[model samples]
Every structure is written in C-alpha cells, then in structure tokens.
Target: MDYSQLRFVVEIVETGSISKAASNLFISQPNLSNQIANLEKILGKNIFYRSNRGVTLTSYGVEVYSYAKALVEQYAMVEKKLMTRSNENKIKIASFGSEVINSQFFEICKRYNENNYEFNLCECGVEAAIQKVNMRDCDVALIIYSDFQQNKLGQLLTAQELELKNLFQGQLKIHVSQKYPLSKKSNITRKDLEGLFHVKKAYLFEGMFSLDYELQFLGIPENQKTILANGNKTYNDALHNLPSFAIEIDWKCNKALPSDLNRIPYENKNLPITCGLVKRKNEFLKEELSFFVEKLIDAYG
Candidate 1:
C-alpha cells in the first residue's frame, strides 16, 4: 500500500525470510511482520505462505512481489542529479538459458558500484543470441536450440563466424497445473494435451516471429488453443490460474510459483534440446566477461 511496504516485500523475497529482511531493513522482526500484515489487509489477500522453515510466495504473492520489486527499483531511478555516461565497464550478455543465470550475473555484478559500470543481460532465443554475439553487441550469449534445428543453426554460426560450446542437454517438457489429470503422469503425449490450451512464448528472429511457429516447426498440431505469452509473468499466470499447460525446456530453472505445478517430459516430441554458450570465433572474453562465463558453466553443472 505504501512505498515502504513495497520495499518490505522485495527485501523479504530476496532474503527468503522475514526476520532476515527485517534485519536488513534495520527494523524489528515484529514491526516488519506487522507492516506486511497491514499491506496484506489493504490488498485483501495473503501475500505469503509461512512455515517454520521460511516463506514462499502464494500465487497472488508472486504477482505482488513482481510489481513491488519493479516499483521499488523504479523509485530508485528517480534521481535529480545528472551524470555523464561511461562505457568503461560495460558488460553485455544475452541468455536463453535459465533465470538462474540472471541471478548469478546480478550476484557478481553486486561487487561493483553500479554507477561506475554498465551491464546488459538479455533473455532471448537462439538466433537472436547468436546475432548479438556475431554483431559484437554482446561478448557472449547463453542460448538453446532443438537438435532439430542444429544443421541450420550450425550454418548460421559458420556464416556469422560464431561458435558454440555445448553445456547441457534436456528433453523439452510440458508443465501443467496440479489440478489437471495429466499432472499425475511421468510423461505426457500429444494425445494427452489434445484439449487443454497450450501456453507458449513468441520470439522474434530477424524481424520475423510467430505465435505457433515452434509447434509447427516441431510438427506438432495445435488443435485446442495457443496463447502467445511475451514474458514470464503472463506465461506463469496462465498456468497457475487456468487449466493451461506450457511446453518448455527449462523445467529446472523458471522462477515461477510452485503453485501446484507438475512437469512431465513431452513424449510426443523427443527433441534433443541443447543449452550452450555463443561467442565470436576469435573472441577472447575480458576479465569481467570471463567471470560471467565461469559462473554460467558452474551454474549449468
């Protein structure tokens, strides 16, 4: 309800504990708890599920924390003093890997005064990631592609003088809400997803993008419904709030609410999905960039 309450939500989620957030905020635990309780009262919904171990976001809490974190960061951007820009510490990386990589990048970036350096971490598809690296806009990128697209991907990399370092492989999976009957299964077939709507993200590659491109490319049929989600929040909200399901490769790393979710490898498509790093063939990463690469390699392991 208030600016401080938004700060409280962001801090708690970051620390993963109320008492920790209170300590970081220089306030008593009871005062922190009461402030959050008051905010929940104003919003008319519980923002967290508490236990002795700690707290996790309720479905509504996910939405609140997202907005709260964004608002808090936005508030920090309201500055009256103007400063000149410097390109001295620019660190740019694009990823199609996992949200975990984002966390790692930020954790390392925290070691610096942000005003003294600049960084850009982008979440993007394979082609875009390759293009960024090829154009030298980014020193490197973490990306993924279906083995089905490997040859074409290889040719593109060759033409662009890009190289790939394979890190890990995973089967693309279908994640459904726990209430769905498919959730009980160890694997899901195309027939099982016949009637329920499928959630997917639309990515732009070379100024061309499509909503059903992925399914069509994989030779899968979209008989029921297909929703075009543009970001994490929309994609997640559809799964938690509806009987919809998502077909994705990174079941291991999405920062979604575990709001009764289940994942089963999609038996319908046994595509070998590869997550890897992309960089210019002759590129030698600088010190900070090399640190990021090491962090990503450790994270993928």
Candidate 2:
C-alpha cells in the first residue's frame, strides 16, 4: 500500500481530527479522507471509528502503523548504507614498496577519484600482494618484479591463467660492510671474496629461495653463503656482524652507508638479478593498479 497513506493515518491520530491533520499536512480534508479510504481498502480492514469525537484506531490500524513506521525507517537506513559502500569502491590499490610509487601514479588515481571513484589501499610484500589478486581479495596486485617473475621464489604466476604485465626494471648491486678489512676497495674482484664470510639480503619466503638458486650460478657453495634476515632489522644486524650486501633498485643504492659499511661493486661479473612488476594474465585489472604500474615504468623504463 502507499506509505503516504500510513503517514496520513499517523498524523490524523496525533492531531485528533482529519481537519487538523489536513492543516498540518497542507492538504485538503477531502483529499486526506480519500487517501485513508484507499489505505483501508488495500489493508481489507476499517482503520478508524469516525464520529464527532474525532477518530480512534481499530486494533489492525495500530499494528499497521507500528510496522509501517518501522519499515520507512529501515528503508532510509538501507539507502544510507548503500551510498557509503558505493563511495568506497572508487579506487582500490595494494603495493609492496614505498619507493615503488611515483607522481604519475598518484596523478592517475587522483584523476580517477576526481571523476568520482572510490579507492582502497593495501601495502604488502610481493608474494602476499599477489595472493590478494588470486583470492580476489583485491581487484589488483602491485607486486615486486622478482617475486612476480620467479616461480620458485614463492607463489608462481600461471602465465596462461593470468596475464604477466611488465612495469619497469632496475639493477641491484653488491655492497660490502666498511668494517671489513677489504671495504676500502671501490671495486672488489671475484677472487678477493673467495674465502671471506659473506651474507646476502633475501625475502623470508620465495625471495630467499630464488636467491639461493641464483647463488649457485655465482659458484658460491650453499654452505659458504648466509641469507641475511628478511627485513630491515635483519639486514642491519647482519651487516654489523658479517660482510653482507643488499641488492635493491639503484635509488635505494644511494642511502648513507654505515660509517664502516662501504658500498662496492660485486667482485663477480655474473651476479644474476632483475626486478620489476607483474599482473595476472587475463584478470580484469584495477585502474589504480594499472596507473601505479604505468608510473613505475615511466620512471624506470
């Protein structure tokens, strides 16, 4: 039935007379009476007992008034919830490193948002980031190049199942702790590192695994090389205790080294490394994720 009629019934009961209710509603009393008559017809029950004493509601009218008022309130509440959720979907983004993002990326997302889009941001490691895509937990995954490309590293991307999109590539160099007696050398030859205690930074999961495999190509025996702790804590401590090198993009290569920690070229010419971004083969890509990747490519390409 018409919700307006429900309101009319409620107003008439409050004002104690159709004439008073019509004045409050700014509607003609005749029009108000017709609406009440229509509502009673739809409900198949008489709602009011009419007389010079104004109107009193029957039992059925009381029940409908309670339910109708509740229904109108709930309907308004549902509309509000839907509006909030719609606003949130404008943009959704998940990325690995802070350095990975650039201005072009932000500009793209900003434009989308200006055009009325919602966004969600998730910061995670390369491997975990990709899982967000596979599980559909996120619309797009911004992952590290090494983690995205190397299957044995952690979770392997199915080239056929998901599109592998490239973003940018950069070089990671071998560094040394300055405290080491040999730290003074701007460049260390492969022979100079043959017997020194050595460490390398790697991820806790697939990054370490792939680094282990790649080291074999460097002729470093498994027993000779140490996988430094995954994150910054382990990276700093390992550098303090032993001769280790961190391999990261060139930008990160310029940070101030520990007083004794020296940045040096790898003694070996054949240090195997490559870093970039990736996405699923055929999945519908997220606009923000795409924008972020494009920015990375434009900056580092």
Candidate 3:
C-alpha cells in the first residue's frame, strides 16, 4: 500500500536478512519486522523462508517480489518523468558484466546525460541482472552470452519479456596455460583432451553447458574430465590447479587475456559470441531507454 513497505520487502530480498535490511535502511529491526508482518497479512503469503544461513524466497514470495519490484520501478519512473519536466531528472540503470561494471557503459550514459541528467548504476551477474529488468526493477539490462545452452538463452529472453538486438559477433577459443604439455604442440586434437581437469565458473551455469559440447567434440570420456565449479572468483585462480580450457570470443577475449595465458585460437572457427541490450516488451520502453540502447551498440560497433 505504501512505498516504504514495498522498499522494505525489496531490501529484505537484497540483503537477505531483516537485521541487515534494517541497518541499511536506517530503521529499527522491530519496526521492519512489523512492517513485513503487516505486508504479509495484506498479501496472505509468506515472502521469505527463514533459515540460519539467511532467507530464501518461497514460490509465493518470488511472485510477490516480482510484482512488488515492478510497482517500485514504475513509481521511480513517475518520479523521473516529473523531475525531467522540471529539468532535475536522473536515469537509473543496471548491467551484468565486468566490462560494464568497470565503466565501459559510461560512454553511452555520458552521451545521454547531455541534458545534465544524473545516472544511478548497478552491476550484477548475467542472470540476476536480467531478472531485475524483467521485474521492471531497472530501465535496461545488458548481458553477454559467453557460454550457450540449448534453448536456455532463448528461454531467458522470452520468459523475461526481453529482446536481444545483436551488436556484434566475436570469436570463442580454447585457451591453455604455457606450462601445460599442450603448450608445446602448435594445436591440440580432439583426442588430446582426455583425463583433463576443467576449471569452470561455479556461478555461471552456462560455463558447464559450453564445456559439455567441447568435451563431446574432443572425444574425451565424460568421467575422466573433472569439471570444478568455482564461486565469484575468476578462472585465473583455478588455472594452476587444473588443466582447464575456457571458451572466449574475439571481441571480449582480446581485452580479457592475461599475459601469462596462451590463447589457442579456435581459428576461423564458429565460436562467435553475440552481445546485446535486452529490454522488456515494446509497451514498457520509453524514448530515453531506446536512445540509451542505440548508443550502447553504436559506441561498441
């Protein structure tokens, strides 16, 4: 019924604890608890399942959170529209990649800020960022498809009510460490990948998906290859631990390569990655949001 209640729910989901959300919101824990209780009473559903580790959204909670997020976003939009009329508007957006997080996206935002606009930016993982856009939590979502799965990416696009406008295609290659035995060979064969330990990004489910096909192509026995899923840490940490090879596309990989890492070019191969801006349906899009997406593609292309 109120903005603070909706915000309290969102903050709870974000921080994963009532205490932390209360601390961040600069409110009392008991007050926050009472607000949530009142919200639950109105909604007739439990928004969070509590545990020792933290809180998890129940199925009902997920549904409520999605709608609540959309309502909050629309409220922000109303505020922005009012401020824009008064020449005090600020654009709030979120992205899902390291490059975007490291200020790669600023060019587009800066270009659009010609009206002396303020911008609020947040960065998160690919899936999570998409979710935010889908729920109308942010104005736009930009994601990269470094790894692909059968219908998985497509599903996300459709399920999230997003459209992917392809910016450019980049090459994906298998890379190895210079110390590895394969480093001596100019190129590796499909048969050479057996008994290799594969280092994968634990956070990215797609990392495992990409490796499945690569392994199949290499004729490597599934059981022999060890796929280790790691957390938020980069793949560089797993380099020495396992004889790992990851797929990297040309555009993204060129800047991403480390001096010590040797890139075995998948060479004129079809490992192209397509990066783009994702937005909700046409009805949800506004003029500034459309211009923002256009500028992103233009800046990179």
Candidate 4:
C-alpha cells in the first residue's frame, strides 16, 4: 500500500472513528472509506470491522495497524526532512519512568532545544520501551528490571541486536507522607504496611503484568487496599491526603516530589533493580546522547 493509504489506516486507528479521522486528515468520509476498501482489496484482508458505534481492528488488522503506525511515523519524518531541506537531528527517548528521570535529564533536552533540535519522549512500560528501540523509532531507552528479569530480557534484547548498559542499581522503596504513621521507620517490612491504603503506578494494555506480580515484587499481600495512579503527582497526593503508601525505585533526592514525603527502604526478599540504558548494538553515540549520559551520571550522583 502507498504511504498515504497507510497514513489513512494510522489516522483511523488513532481517532477510533472514520468520520473523525476524515476531519483530522482533511478528507471526506466516503473517500476515506474508499481508501480503506482499496487497501483491503490489495491485501485481501479486512483492516477493520465497521459498525454504528465505531470501527475496531480485526484480529489481522491489529497486526497491520502496528506496522502501519511505525511506517507512517518514518514516512512523515522523511517527508519533513525533504520539505524543510535541512536534516535536523531529533532525539527520540522511550523510558519506563521516574527511576531515570531527574533534573539532569531535562537539562539535556533544554540544551538541545536551544539549537532547535526536536525530541520525542514516551513514558511507557518495559515492553513498549523495548519495542520502540527494536522498531528504530527511538534512539535510546531507559529501563529498570530486577536481575532475575535480565536472564530472559537480556537474551531477547541481544537477539534483537540491542545493547543494555547498566548505569547503577536502584533500591526499590515505599514512599509515604510525613504524616503517615509508619513514616518515621527507616526500613519498612510488609507488616508495617499491612492493611494500609496503597497508591501505585500501573501500566496497562502494553503488556501489563498482573496486579499479583506487582504486589509480589513489592512484598505486599493481595488483600492490601490498593488504588491506581498513573504518575508521581497523584501518588504523592494520595500519600499526602490519605493513610497510604507508594512504591518506586528510590530516587529520594528528587526535588520534583514533595519534601514532606518519607522514603523508606522496603525490606523483603531481595529484588535488585538495575537501572540502565538501551541502544542499538554498535551504534556510535551522538554528542547529545553523550551529554545525556554525562548528565544522567550527575543526576544519579
């Protein structure tokens, strides 16, 4: 299929409706439908199951959409370069989250942007971050996994021609408001947190690990009261306003989080987290990436 046709597929999937997608793409609904029909005939596979409610991808359509979205992104990148006549450098970053995000990370972005460079930073799960690197959509990725995950995850990354550089080991800890009853404790055991409300960061749909797995890793019981918050702000709010706790790879010195929070090491069966960088194998580091690495070191220190 042509780039425009693939672009059509990506737009439709993104908007989740042909009519809205048509509006966004500046095309008529009938023309968009015809384009989809022509593409389906070419591939001999129905790309979407149309309905009154909206369109959803068929089983095979889901597979097609993934590749189509990536192809669309690359095509647009090339088109932008061709039109502008300037080969601008764009730093694409895919990250698991807060363990690696600190003040120094943004400093690098600020430095690059001052020179008119572009950036794409996605806060995603482990699988999504790895997928971005594998698909060539990202220049580098920041990730965290226990040593136990490294045996399998390492091999898989190597097979995909990716390299993982361990930056440092992060201590996983439970954070609570200073107002929390157990906040004074230096080390937290499961018993100390038992029956308390918990605010947690959870990833969904992009290869989500079950809640049992999260609880197991945090050394908490299944019966513990839990609520889900998508980012640190909400996690902090929950801890501040309620008798709750949250888990994160300890970046206790982060100024972005509230000063009144208490970060206590979670003492349980050892879960050694390795925070690191992932990049394509044998790739030469760009100046921005080098600066990013140096600043990352400073941020961690």
Candidate 5:
C-alpha cells in the first residue's frame, strides 16, 4: 500500500527471491516475509508461488507487480524532484573510467568549488554508471569502452534512451610495476602476456561481465589466472605490488602514473578506446553539467 511495500514487491519480483530481495533492501528475511504475508492476506490472494528454486508471480501477482513497479517509479520521481528543489545547486556526477579519478579531474572540480555548488561524485563500473544515467539517478556519467564495443554500446545507450557525447580517444596500454621484467619494453604483444596474471576492475553488478573489453580482446580464456580489484586505487596497487598487469587507456595512465609504475603500449590491433559522457536523451544540459563536460574535454581530449 505504501511506497516501502511497493518497493519490496518490485525488488522481490525483480530478484525472484524474497531472501535475495531482503538482502538487497537491507531488511531481515523474516520481516520481509511477514510484510508480504500481511499484504497477501489483505488482498485475499497469493501474489507469488513459493518454490525451492525461487518465487514466481501468480496470474494475479503479475497485475499487482505491474502497478507496484509504476508506483515505485513515480515515488522515485517525486523524491528526486523534492530533493532537487531543496538542493537546487547540487550536481551529481558519476564516472566509471580511471580518467575521472586523476589529479586533473580533481583540479577541474576544485574550480567549481568557488561557485558554492554542491557536488556528489561517484566511481562505479560501466554498466552501473549507465544505469544511473538511465534512471536519472545522476545528472551525468563518464564511461569508457573499447573501439570494438562502440556500435554495441551505442545501441545499448539508444535502448536506454540515453545520449553519449564523445570526450577523448586513446590507445590501450599495459600498466605494470617498474620492477616487472616486461616494463623495459616499449610495447608488448598478446603472446607476451600468455602466462601472466591480469588485474581487472570489479563490477558491483554480479553476472554483468560484458564491459571487460581488454580481457575479451586479448582472448584470455576463463581458465587464466585473474585478480579482481574493486576500484582504481586497488587496481593500481595490484599493478604495483603484485605480479600482475592491467590494461588502461593511455591518457588516464599518463595522467595518474605512479613513480614505480610503467605503462607500455599494447602492440596489437583494436587497442583503441573511447571515453564519453552519457546523459538522458533530449534532456537539456544544465550550465553546471555543460561546464564540467567542457573541463573534461579540455583536460583529456
């Protein structure tokens, strides 16, 4: 009946499991179960058929689920509107690529501090960043994709009703510690990385793995040793301290290179990468968002 219950219903339907939904919603399983049971009793109908595998919506449940999803979305819109009204000058931006984490990006952000506008910057994976923009959870998102993923990514953006603006383009480079044996090389081939471990940035969304272009481009098999890092700092630390390497765009690598780390160009075709900003399609770019985008272009492009 309320927004919280509607949210619970929507999440449960999406996840297909009360336990998983409860975990995601940050509530106890028993509490969620009791609430759902109360809702079902009030309606005099079962919303879902519980099973060992998971819960499935009943015929009546499908109708309720549809309304619940719409209500939840409406509630979100109302909440966002209220928040924006109260914090008129606040800007929410998200970035999935390493370029936005460097000193240059921070310097640009500092320039905006003088204007007294509030800024919320977040670092996330490519898919998450796009999702935030699609949902209007953030004003803008900066993400990176390989050249080969251009058409697919464009199609995905179109499907989400989002628009992309290209910001920078560069070649991919392998980041490794200076102590690494291959650091002396100006460029390296795919065969050179055959047995070495690869460090990759981890995505928050489970089972969403298509964004890892570097690994796929190299034809790295599933059996290969791989290390997952949660953020740019962790990924860079792994490159410096562990016997592993990470593939990153050249502009970002050059801007944030550690003294002990070295970036060697990949001597392979299809090593090009493009970084861009994503926003809702047909949405007018606010002055702050436009200014930030210009700063990013000046810094990286």
Candidate 6:
C-alpha cells in the first residue's frame, strides 16, 4: 500500500476513531473510510472492528499497524534527512520539572551549540511531554516520577511505544525555608510537618498518578494545610514566604535552590524518585540528538 494509506492506518489507531483521524488528516470521513476499506480488501483481512465507541484493531491489524508505523517512521526519517537540512539542526525537548530544565537542560543546550544546533525546551507534565514525543513534535522528553509510579509509567510508555532511559535516581526530600522549625532537623518524618502548610506544585496532566498518589501509597496523610502553585516561581515563593514545606527529589533540589531554603531527607524508604529521558521506540536518533543524549548520560547517569 501507499505511504499515505499506511499513515492513515497509524493515525486511525492513534486517534481510535475514523472521524477524529480524518479530521486530523484533513480529509473527509467518507474518503478516509473508503481508503481503509480498500486497504483491508487488498490485505484480505478486516483490520478494525467497528463499534459505537470507536474502532478496535483486530489481531492481524495489530501486526499490520506495527509494521506500518515503523515504515512511516523510516520514510519520514529518509525524507527529513534528504529534504529538511535546514530544520535538521533543531531539537525539540519536553520536560516535566523546572529543576531539570534549569540544571541539565541548559548545560546540554550549551554543548549542543558547539555543534551549531538549536534546541527548544517545553515545560509540561508527563503525559503532555509523552504526547509531544509520540506525535513527533519533540525529539525527546525528560520526566521525573516517583519509584512507586514505575509500573504505571512503564505501561504508559509502552502504550505510546516510547523508550525510556534512566538518568538519575534520588531519594525524596522535604524543602522548607530555613526559618521553619522542621528545617533544623537533619531528617524529618511525616509527623514532623503535621501542622505546617504544604506547597504542592500543580501539574498539568498528572491524572490519578502523581506525587500525591505516591504519598498516599506511603501511608502518609494528605497534606491538611495545602497550597497549590501553578509554576516554579510561585511554588518557591510559597516555600520562602510562608511557613510551608514542599517535597522533591534530592538531586533536583541540590542546585537552583534558594539560599533561604534547605532540603532535608525524608526518612521514608518507600519513596524514591526517578528521573529519565524518553524518546520514540525504534526511531533513529539524529547526530545532534545522539550527542545530547550522551551528554545527559555523562552528566547524570
């Protein structure tokens, strides 16, 4: 089949509806349906089982879709290599944490400039970052999740056909202003900050799986005096100005922390943090992207 039809199948699987995929592909629904129907006839197998909800891939359709996706990626790579030299030097990255962006990201960008490449970094939640990579909008994604979330996150990455590489693992710690009483302790427990306000950084796409979920898994009570901050500056302000505490991984807070704030290791063996890089599965990394990935491994791994 033609590359256009292959792309149509992949898009249909991605959107899970012919109407949605047609809208995205800028084609009429009837035309798209006709194309898929012709493809199935050529293959002599029904590719999708239709229902009110949407389309579900049949068993054989799964194999066809897999090969089609790889072919599409390969074709795109060839076209990009041959025709997109001007855009080749640009790398797009999405990240979940400001700490990662401020620390490793800037350093990587500086090194990338040595090769005369340009890069863009977007700060978003894990799901949004994954979507950017899956949709080929970004070359890579950097995200941090608690060890407790490993299984769920793994399933998510698998569903999106993304590959993950571990950059760092850190123990969870509490960040509090130096003036706060809990800051005096070398280590703190859940009980120590019972009455103090907890500054929770609001995530864009955390869903039901997040730091709060991890805390609940650790048997910690939900923060009673909670304040939500939409961004890093506001989160830091809450920690500095108010008698509040925030939880973060040790390595992330090791740098870019205010002088007035201190990071105290929380005495919980159950809560660990993992930071990593993600990219499309089986996709070839361009020269600049490969170089940057190595720099990240050297710096953090």
**Highest-TM-score candidate:** 4
How does each model score on lDDT? 0.75, 0.60, 0.64, 0.77, 0.75, 0.79
- State the lDDT at 2 in candidate 3: 79
Query: What lDDT tens digits, residue by residue, belong to model 1 across residues 9-50?
Result: 999999999999999999999999999999999999999999
Worst 10 residues of 5 by lDDT: 204-213
Deviating ranges (above 4 Å) for candidate 3:
1-103, 106-127, 144-156, 178-186, 206-233, 240-242, 252-259, 266-269, 283-301
Candidate 2 weakest lDDT stretch, 10 residues = 249-258
Error of 4 at 147 (Å): 1.2
lDDT of 6 by residue, 78-122 (tens): 898788656447778888765544566677677667555677888
Over 4 Å off, model 1: 1-84, 112-115, 179-181, 204-220, 250-260
lDDT of 3 by residue, 168-236 (tens): 555555557677777566565555555666555543334323445643543434554545544424566
Residues forming the 10-long window of minimal summed lDDT in candidate 4? 204-213
Residue by residue across 217-294, what tens digits does model 5's lDDT show? 655344267878887678778787767777666664333444676778767544666778899988898876777776
TM-score comparison, 1 vs 2, better candidate: 1
Off by over 4 Å in 4: 1-87, 204-218, 251-258, 268-270
Q: Give per-model CA RMSD.
A: 18.1, 12.6, 10.7, 8.3, 9.5, 10.2
Least well predicted 10-residue stretch by lDDT in candidate 3: 248-257
The numbered model that scores best in lDDT is 6
Error of 3 at 60 (Å): 20
Candidate 2 C-alpha lDDT tens digits along 172-275: 34556666666677666666666555554444235333444444444443444656555555666777676555444433333232344555555434442444
Error at 31, model 6, angstroms: 26
Error of 6 at 125 (Å): 1.7
Local lDDT at 247 for model 3: 45
Give the lDDT of residue 257 in candidate 1: 31
Q: Model 4 over residues 1-301: C-alpha lDDT tens digits? A: 7888999999999998999999999999999999999999999999999888999999999999999989988988888868985437788888866644645567777787755567777877777788899998889888777755667777878889999998767666777888867889888887877778877777521353223454476666554487787776776788898888877666424235436877787775445567688899999878988898777766666
Off by over 4 Å in 2: 1-87, 90-98, 102-127, 142-156, 177-184, 190-209, 221-228, 233-243, 249-263, 281-284
The estimated TM-scores of all candidates read: 0.62, 0.48, 0.50, 0.67, 0.65, 0.63
